[model samples]
Target chain A: MNPAVPTWAGVAASAALVLLAVAVAWHGRLRLARDIAIAATRAGVQLAAVGAVLLLVFQHTGLVGASGWLALMVLVAGQVAARRARGLPRALPIATAAIAAGAAATLGALLALGVIAAQARVVIPVGGMVVSGAMQATALVLIRLRDEARTARPAIEARLSLGLPATDAFAPYLRTTLRTALIPAVDSTKTVGLISLPGAMTGLILAGVDPFTAIRYQIVVMYMLLAAAALASLTAGRLAEHALFDDAHRLRPLTTEPRRERV
Target chain B: MAPDELFALDQVTVRRGRAVLLDEVTCRLSAGVCTALMGPSGAGKSTLLRLLNRLEEPTAGQVRLHGRPLADGDVLALRRRVGLVGQQPVLLTDHVPDELRVGRPDLAEGQARTLLEQVGLPAAMLTRQTAGLSGGEAQRLCLARALAVGPEVLLLDEPTSALDAASAKAVEQTVRRLVAAGLTVILASHNIAQARRIADEVLVLRAGRPVAHGAAADIDYLKEES
Candidate 1:
């Protein structure tokens, strides 16, 4: 079955599956019928638009066009991550920069080493994965850092009043924040094939690629995500550490920001 | 600029939103002076002490150190010279010695031992973990940690309110000894008797206003003037 372009019959079957999910939620009284229906509708519409755009992009695939697409992905991801740490100084720019750096570093290494091609088709899919992984890591790091700064105020202030520089006082908490952000990525990588065939490998196999070759690509993707996550966490954590302090070497009082709802 | 003055708060006012944390406070403390800040909770005792080291800057006023406004001096250097010991025993590191060696990474065991001894903690405490310490022991450790930086002036907030009688006495004696050696100390305490024992001068606040400033012996000499 060609998963990329589904037949009318195939589309109907998928639509039925969505209805089943909605029905199940309604039966269980999970109060998620509207949520499930809304999510499915959004996914369907978004994927359709992306598919059409990708077709045009692949037709005129060039270095410039591919780069533009990647930039857009990073910008969107950064904005999403920034929302997780809204009250922080330069939150939007910092989030975008960290995610971009992580994705670029990982993808650059992969292309240079001949693990992935530089074509728009190859770069976009793999780059999307890399960017998404980095965004998750960065958002988690920022949120955790803010929380730790609040909870550990007394401990940090003690160090500050003892004449320790802001960087030195905040160093331990930064390490803890990075560790918390990286753990999920590391755990997923560790349990990859043991738990289940991952998304990339499963898609490749279902699309008629050799299972062995698909596994090889999936392995590279796993390593790519790990590298991206670590890079993003490091960049975001250090930038955040600097943001937390004032020129007077005192911790800036972090004001609470309202939570925003996203579609 | 009085030659004897160590700290001068000139028309200082600190406001948090609509709440006044400190209101038009103006005072002077001489070098080698041990001044106790006494008042009930929310009396701005801690807020007044924080100004000595710029832990909390006043919104509308000036805090001068050695005739030089704190705003003009190198803040990092100023902090090194003016240390602080918070009301709570805050030990950042898991072990006792690491907490003392926060900024002074190269501090030797002998130096750590001396600081612990000065704060009435045993030398063995230097090698011990901070997790096992009692409230009084932790308080002394915090004192030793502050002294590790060799500050010229120390700000202590409710320092001995949590300690036992003997431990409190030892801490009070340390404050007196340090003052005798020419260091200035500003302590925030609710205990009137403690203030009388160690403070050479006392500043009593009521709801963020300095109601009285005089000799420690005259702690009971305050009369509310309408």
Candidate 2:
């Protein structure tokens, strides 16, 4: 089923919304107008490129092409997450593993249960959602773990001096970061239908599907996102914890360590 | 090289970014002796104490504990034998008993009370929260927590600097008792008089360099300051 086509005029009209945002930022002296403009331009260009690629894959590729698309998305998502996880060693690899694990667990369960169709059109969109959610959770977990590890260095060292293993010494901070990382997912999920119509449900309804049917899909999406977030946050938090401490069970301060600062 | 040598820092050096916190300094701290690390603010007293417990690894050289390389054995076990009370009191848990049980979770109430008493805190302190403690009380609590693990060597980083005169004296007495009982102490202090009183040996550091290290009484600067 085809949705209403947007002409260039319509695209320009929609792009004008970014100017409004830029105007407000300029008025407030927020110094974000340039960033906002750049981000909007990048988003438009990237989405256009992704759309062209997806169309090509849909026409000429099978399950392999679809899987390749998902893998590519996972890698890109990992890089995005790693950008936010400054001062963490092996952040790129760790983020990739976490995002991959979360996405696999989420999509695997849905696929096994026959909840989502195995078509490329279905898998790519659902995988994108799962990977995006996982990326966000992973990045949040890493950032929180890094910041809390620095601030709580004294307490962590105190635990280490007590002869506690590195994992045991870092357990409290890991728990805190995990909880903090999962907060957004939990809050948004709880308030989904009440506060806002999430992207999936909006898309489904706009695709001429029944509202009640769209509601079913939205619930599944919410559940999958929750699962992805928990899995990703735990993986990233645990991995980052291991990175922060040495074999001597002593804390190596994240910022102080001679690491390549992501500037 | 003596059989009684507890911690031997063979040219141990620590650098943070562009600053050299501890220069090439070789010193052997004997077992069952109280060794004070005396220095000015940035003279690396804390850095030296941390080295003994293997808290901060040196940028260069080696640290040998009990005649073995510090990295030879399990670090957790090493830390248990060599405990550390940092400059500030950072009790793991809010309550006294729980804080004591942080590393040793199987700690009994009686044992907790005994550790408290050993640190000059009353047994009644077991019921108190760490949040309400005074500077001296908190430092003593940190000491009690360290003692709870039954460490052979205790590292104290300015353990009494934050306390008032009376509280400092109380901590000093506790240290004397521990030393008499054959516990090794590597203390970091700015107070020269305090060092002379408590330390059997003193290693004077000036700008991270070892200026002098000998028996506390024989150290001319320490004697002169006294």
Candidate 3:
């Protein structure tokens, strides 16, 4: 059975499976069947668009074009992360810089070490995985940091009024946010092959790669994700902490309203 | 400005959007005296107190500490000299001693014990978990934590409003003792009797404006105004 090319029949079968899940959701009165259907449809359309673009880049693009594609992905991911962190100041720039730095550093190290060749087919997909992981970490850190600043206002203010510096006052919250952001990456790495086959390994095996080679690549991907997530979350957390306080080291009133004006 | 004035609010006004939290308020707080701020809930008593320590900035006018603007020097140093005890006691750490040692990490155990005793808490309770303390005990612990920094002026916003009669009395006596020891204190309270008992002067607020300012015994206008 050739797994390289997927037919429309296979896609239809997948849609039927989704319908079965949606039916069960409706039966349970979860009220999420519609949401599931919408999300699944959106995912299909988005993935198909991305697949078309990647095929063009892989077939004809040089390094510059491949890099441009990667930058576009990072930009889109940053916008999504910033939207999730709507009330925070300078969320877009902060998320973009963090994600780009994390993905670039990890991918650069892999290439420099000669572990992966700098080909469009290899670099583009690996870069996408790294950027996506970092984007998720950045978004989680920003959201959690904003929440901690809001919910722990009294405690943070108490410390500040006691003459503690802003950094010292927000230390506990920063620690908690970073830990929470990094947990998913760490847990997925731990359970990668034992509980569930990860996407990279599964895709490579289905593409007729040797099992050993696929496993090795998956391990490298996992390690890169953990490093990238840590870097992105720490950077985003540090930048977001400044937005929580004013120049006087006082807790700035949490901006509850949506910030429509970009700085 | 008076010679002994420790804090002066000059034509201060604080507005949040269209809502005026504090109107034009000008007053002097003398050193080594407890000035009780008495007003209704929305009269901006807490907002007024916050301005003294720059917890909330004024939209107009200025706050002066010792003939200098409150925003002049290092804010952290200013906040250290002007300690604040919020209405609800919030401890950062589990142990009572650790709570007291938040900013003052070099605080000696004996000094911590003394602060606990000063606030009418048993010295032995310093080692106990803060979460295990009752409401009144926690309030007193917060007071001790404030005193741990050795602040010259203390701003308390309804510190005893949440405590029972006995605990309130204990806190009131502690404030009185501190005032006697030359600690300047500004306290906000809804309890007029409490104000009369511990305050040397009374400043009555009405809808973000100061309606009366005089000796504690002479502010009988509050009884009619409130």
Candidate 4:
């Protein structure tokens, strides 16, 4: 083999991806373009750092390092969820609780079923997918819950005065609000196969895996995602209810709290 | 016991965010009588009524219903007996009269229809979607809803503020009828004519405090302002 294709091919591919990202950024406003440029640079550096570490860790350390990688994924996921809901005072705890409950439960079930083995290579990627899905669900549910509580406060108070218990009085609105938040996950689940084959399934097939094996993996992943999304949304919804109401059952002003400014 | 002394407030004071929304606001609402609150904007007119219902907790005073202290244990029980209506009448997006009456399975279909008629709404409107009801019709529906709970004291908070002249007159007539039927009505409004026409007593609030409160006909200050 005259000269095996340069190991730098991976770097060259990433550089090309960066160029395309910059071109897209150029079409936006200057502020957005600057943000995009900074984000792309950060992402590239972080990925490269992880890639180097992974190369050494996988070669030397065994299963223990792999567990570290899985835990790292969860930590990153929690941070992203918190960042997304930074404006809400109750976001951090709600986000972490949601992501942890959702990812762990769904992932545990899948691993036990042998859909994904206990191997870190398989476990980490699937867990990352499930956790990220939960994070998005948590963010959406919290935003909707906060907004609906404010907009419909009068109605809630009216129901309360009608001799309905606080929770029962809020049940109608909570149902509507939670259902609205879950619509995205519901829609995605409904349109999954017909709209497009997901990346993991497509990639597995491209790598010479049998069609039936790819289909099995895709089905398992999709169901786990739905499971994760539902759990996260429900947990976030419950937390939001607590955060919005005081111990006396009076509504707390969601907008009154001073939010920390992003750096 | 006379219905005239149905509800009483003993030096109720409430603070909201460093502002004294109600200070030493003592008043009594009589059964089968219409009491109107008259004051300029930002006067504690609305806040005073909210206190009677225990919707807002008092900072340094107590509210008594039927001569008993209003406390956490009695709040829900009292609230069920008190019907409070606000300016913008809100109805849930779904549900017609039937759904609202589910808990009180004893509520007859005829009673629901009669409620609509009492509020001057067509019985046909009850079957219609709440989304399609006009401001006037919806206010009437809200009144009907409040009546469904069988309240003894009706707290009216600018109940006609969002209605047209015709709708306002309709709602006022409804209130008049309710008052005639032995319900204690506490009406909060800024309109002098409204107070004079229906109120046996008047309470004026200013700067989160009651500046003037007494019989409507005897208050010369209202004449000066109106």
Candidate 5:
């Protein structure tokens, strides 16, 4: 083990730290505080459930089981993303494309480059991380794009009247808005070493990995995140633009549908 | 449903959390004519205009365009056919003329210049930042944007209420020209004199209800009541 974490107690302490987070979440009285508490409790249950499933999958090594596990991850991620985007375009397809693309590319690269064998242990965590990152990027991009689309409605209508196609009409605003969404990933990648060390690289170093190997892994992960975020943002942005326009190239009215009143 | 009747609100009523914003309001707006919706600040004139374009759906009534229900029709097509210009003149672009032609980024810059010119703005404003535009320039730009869509019906909510006399006159002249070009105009304004100068028909609204509706030239009684 590396000098930073030479014993198993460090991992144990990390696990215990989650309890403090739960306590803090519960003690707070804000609107989202209860939600945070619920989310933390749910996360604990989910992690345990996932661990039980993974324990069986690792031992069996069957294709059906492995694919099923991945599918569950994708489905859960997509559903969460869609719920976050309450009214914007269909979030499932965007999340699916983003997660599939990001996971496949990153996992494939890691295996081909011989970073680790195509074993269950290495593949599952790394794939999950890539998918999760892509999901976050997709959500941010979709929300930002939707808001920008509304803000740019007048400009869009102006172009439509000027005889432009729906796609062509939203291109200018869409371009800038999508670019803005990708900035976080870009800045994180650019300033990785000079500003702050990334979590994965630091964890690996603490776990006794060689400095050079850790750095290479970090570099690859950073590039993968960039690729994933850019692809996801672009896909989600285009999807949003299409969803908001009609066949005759007119902008659709935004909905303000009231929540169903319970008797 | 006449070709001339570009927009018509038929027994439209709007409620906000159980409070009536507009109640059973009926009005017909025609082509090649300016109709001023004269009312106090809180009257439903702006809300009524929003209903005409399906910007806000009515709680219990329907708006019609060409004799068909506004809700039943495609919203995008309707909005494209009817353009809106508000008091604030929200120009959703930093690149001025370029942003104005967003969907058709390939559209010639000169076309945008022509639109600015038509709205009483100098062609030089084509390159200026939209944020830098004066209130009058911004208002004209909004009109230019509305006109850019080739809308048969135009909804103007206090188009000149925020401008100086010179700018107001310029905007009023543009409205007259638009009417002359066969575009339908529905304007909501507090300026009675400006209304008389520009409107062919006038509808007086009080407390979200229409009290009087008729030709603008027959407004002597309305003036007496004021």
Candidate 6:
């Protein structure tokens, strides 16, 4: 049986469901109705733009153009992640290096092993997935590491007073932050088939691929995400740990103002 | 400044933006002496203690150890020799023994027990969880952990401020014993009685400047503050 291609009518129907949800939220006095509406519209526009761009690159680009596109994705991801980790010195460079290294290493290995075809069609999508996963993990690790270091100042200073190096003093907090950062990816992998079908597998199956083939692709994607997230979190944590302290090994006082308390 | 001074601050000043936390204060701490920094709240007593280990840097002038500038040496090595116990106890691990051994993992269990005994805690408390410890017990545990580094100088910042009267006495006695063991101590205390009881000399601070520095009995400024 041939897979049915989604037409403009199908897209409109999906959007109508979002409008209905927004109406329900508005009736319940949920202030999030506006946010829901705006987010749905934004997601639709962004996805359409991405789809067009990917088609152009897949049809016309060689390896050089594909790599350039992948680099652009990584750059944008790094900027977003760095903004989330605002107030950290050198956060942008740190996030960029970590995400790039993680995505490059994982994609390089997959390509070298001949597990995935070395074409723009496979590399761009797979590389985009790896980069986004690392971006998320890096952002969480940076933010958590900074927050933990600030709140745990007394403990860190106590350790430093006993002659422990900054790296050794921050070991426990780093471990906690890395674990927190990677748990999301780990959990999704664990619950993939049981809780819900992931996007890759569902997409492949809907595109007329056999179920077993989709499952195999989904498994590889899950493992690759875990590897990328782990590497990203660890690298980001290590770099952020140094930023928390000064050359004298003293905790640098956080310059950012405390977040306003929610009423 | 005496040639035998262990620590000497010459016109040391610390500024946080526009406000000066510590003004141009000069003092000398002689070797093997217990010098108490007596001040009211926010008078820079804790800031002065922090300077000894380079936890906080002075904005102006200099702090010298053994007649050499503190900035001249490796800070980690300097902190190892000059240990600090903060106003509140902070432990990294759940168990008392692990907290004690955190700084010195090579420390033997028996040696840790001996340190606990010196701090007036029972050796059996070593196995107890740090979360279950009383405030005083936690403070003493911090002290024991500081001692694990074998520091030549110890800085205590309101070490007994959170303790009950009896707990305060235990900590005070432990500190006295450490001083007698030839460990130089710089203690920051708001309690005049505690300072009088333990200090050989007193440096009185008011609004970040030293108003008096002399023998504890001779310094009448503390009496006025009281």
Q: List the residue pairs that clash in candidate 4.
A: none
Scored by lDDT, the top model is: 6
Predicted candidate 4 versus true structure: per-residue lDDT over A94-161, tens digit per residue: 77887888888898898787777776567667877888888888877776666667778888777766
* A1-263 per-residue lDDT for model 2 (tens digits): 13355676788888889999999999999999999999999999998998999998888896679999999999999998887877787789999999999999999999999999988888999999999999999988987787877789889889989898889988998988898999999999989999999999998788788999999999999999999999998888878877888777778856544345464
Give a tens-digit lDDT track for model 5, residues B118-209: 77788887768888878887888878877766678888989988899988998999999888878889999988888878999888887778
Candidate 4 regions exceeding 4 Å error are A1-6, A20-36, A52-89, A206-208, A247-249, A257-263, B1-4, B93-106
Q: How big is the positional error of residue B9 in model 6, measured in Å on the Cα after superposition?
A: 1.5
Lowest lDDT block of 10, candidate 6 chain A: A254-263
Q: What lDDT does the true structure give each of the candidates?
A: 0.87, 0.88, 0.89, 0.76, 0.75, 0.90
A204: Cα error in model 4, Å: 2.9
Error of 2 at B50 (Å): 1.8
lDDT of 3 by residue, A1-263 (tens): 35575687788678988898899999999998998999899999999998898888888886777899899989999998888888777889989988998888899999999988899989998999999999999999988887788889889888888888889999999998999999999999999999999999999988889889899999999999999999999889888887777888877776566555343
DockQ of each: 0.70, 0.83, 0.76, 0.41, 0.19, 0.85
lDDT of 6 by residue, B1-226 (tens): 5766898999999998888999998988878989999988989999999999999999998999999999999999999999999988787899988888888999999999999998889999977999998888899899999999899999999999888998899899999998898998899999999998899989889889998998898999667756
Ranking by DockQ: 6, 2, 3, 1, 4, 5
- Write model 4 residue lDDT over B128-171, tens digit each, in one string: 88887778888888888878888888888898889998888888
TM-score of chain B of 6: 0.96
Off by over 4 Å in 3: A22-38, A257-263
lDDT of 3 by residue, B1-85 (tens): 6888898899999998789999999998889899999988999999998888788999999999999999888889988999999
Ranking by lDDT: 6, 3, 2, 1, 4, 5
Worst 10 residues of 5 chain A by lDDT: A254-263
Best of the two (2, 5) by DockQ: 2
Give each model a TM-score: 0.91, 0.91, 0.93, 0.87, 0.72, 0.94
Between prediction 4 and prediction 6, which has the larger lDDT?
Answer: 6
Which pairs of residues collide in candidate 5? A161-B149, A168-B103, A169-B103
- For residues B1-226, write the lDDT of model 2, one tens digit per residue: 7988988888888998899999998888999999998889999998888887788889999999878998787888888999999887787788988988887889999899888888888999888988998888888888888988889999999988778998889889999989998899989998988997899999999999999999998888687665
